[model samples]
Target: MNKEYTVTDDEVGTRLDVFLSNQPDNPSRSSIQKMITDGAVSVNGQTKRANYKLRLSDNIVMTYQPLQEIEVQPENIPLDILYEDKDIIVINKARGMMVHPATGVYTGTLVNALLYHCHGELSGINGKIRPGIVHRLDKDTSGVMVVAKNDFAHNSLAEQIGSKTAIKEYVALVHGNITEEKGIINANIGRHPVDRKKMAVVTSGGKSATTVFHVLERFKNCTYVKCRLLTGRTHQIRVHMAYIGHPLIGDPKYCNSKNKFNIEGQALHSLNLTLNHPRTNQQMTFTAPIPQDMQNLLNYFRQTI
Candidate 1:
């Protein structure tokens, strides 16, 4: 394919690859660099490096071949399906299940299973890599999630979540003694300045995040709580809880405490999800049973107390 772009005054001084990345349906930056290196991209009819800076009214032409599609293979992994219809599928996802494939993880994910089950019925708006995935739960956060079967459902669900009309509730066991029955942790979350991989509660240069938590039970040292997110920032619950001196029992990124409970991952689970049906506009709620690990831990705490 071939296209021509005339640089505008507002876009001056941007790198060649950066400019291409902003284009709709453009290839990855690395791919753009490759195209530039192969003389596929020319500025004013002359080839230039990927780092070439744009100038006002500069005429640029680019030619490239689309990368071949590599389909994600479907796996016959059994899913704990909660509800299924032509429009959506609700599942009680297990802990350790990646919602979609990531770098170096191409199989054994929820996407692969969804591919097999839905059989090409998944929505294509997110592309092949993340077909049907509406929102995601972290790998260790097991619980209720919905997958879209078509584009209409996908758009509706995405809008509801973005507008804060969709309600998602969670259960977690954290290390703390809560005197208050209910509380709200409102903070801004951003990437940790030191550790790029972890999210943190930052005072500035962060997105506003809020978590409303209700104390369900208090152990001698630990507490069981229910949390509802008012804003869906990355690791919002974990970061906010740790900021308030309570971290999920097995959270690897935020908490640095001992794992005496023998929990495999963070003691957090998506307990409830409520949203309106995309087609009927009727309210619907889905629930997932707590994983046995967390349930057993709670039972033991209650029995011993």
Candidate 2:
């Protein structure tokens, strides 16, 4: 569908991509840039770059072809739902489960399960691929996660995370003993220039990321720590810990060597989540118990350390 807008006085001087992203459609900046590059968007009847500054009363027309809807089939995959209400559902997402389906992955995801559980109530803000997913945990990271049932709840929850009002805490077992009881890592993170599959602490052209950690227990060759995310970036906790010489135990991508522990993936868990209720405005918190694999590893540390 095609949409047109005249830049107003208040919108003058905004980047073209930024201005388009703020529209009601809420297209991603990357998507907007792609549209501009493909000549699907124009300012004053001429194509403009994503960084072009807007001028008041400038006519902007965007021709967006709606994505072909891929049917996200409902799966009866069991979910360990922790909390549920009319607006949202909190689940203790198990390890080894993808949050949503992507290309080449169409089933056995949290979204598929939610489709069955919520029964068509999931919000469509994230498109058909990631319906109701306000945020995500890694595939191997077991944790508490919340899903919105409606667009209103989805918007509110997304705002909370964007504004850093939602609190997310994790517990991780890393490969080295952390000396400090508590500390903060302030660094910029972005995609690795050489390795596109991984994230790294880049010196420039990266987003600012902050992670706070407190040592919970120190083992012979590992540290159990609690991490709070001040800014949510992809692989933020894992990258920050690795930058501090304590890459998470069993982390295949970040850690250089195989872990002594027989765990399949990184020993990281989203232990707690806190946020304000979207509808009621009441503060709420949810917690997930440590999974058995991590728990057994911790017990091993307890007996040996």
TM-score of each: 0.78, 0.78
- The models' CA-based lDDT, in order, is 0.89, 0.90
lDDT of 1 by residue, 1-305 (tens): 67789999878999998888566556557767877898988999999889999999989888854333456899999999999999999999999999987533568999999999999899999998899999999999999999999999999999999988999999999987978999999899988865546778888899999999999999878999999999999888889899999999999878899788867889999999999999999999999999999999998889888
TM-score of 2: 0.78
Q: Which runs of model 2 end up more than 4 angstroms from their true locations?
A: 1-69
Give the deviation of candidate 2 from the true structure as CA RMSD.
10.4
lDDT per residue for candidate 2 within 173-194, as digits (tens), equals 9987788999999999998765
The residue pairs in collision within model 1 are none
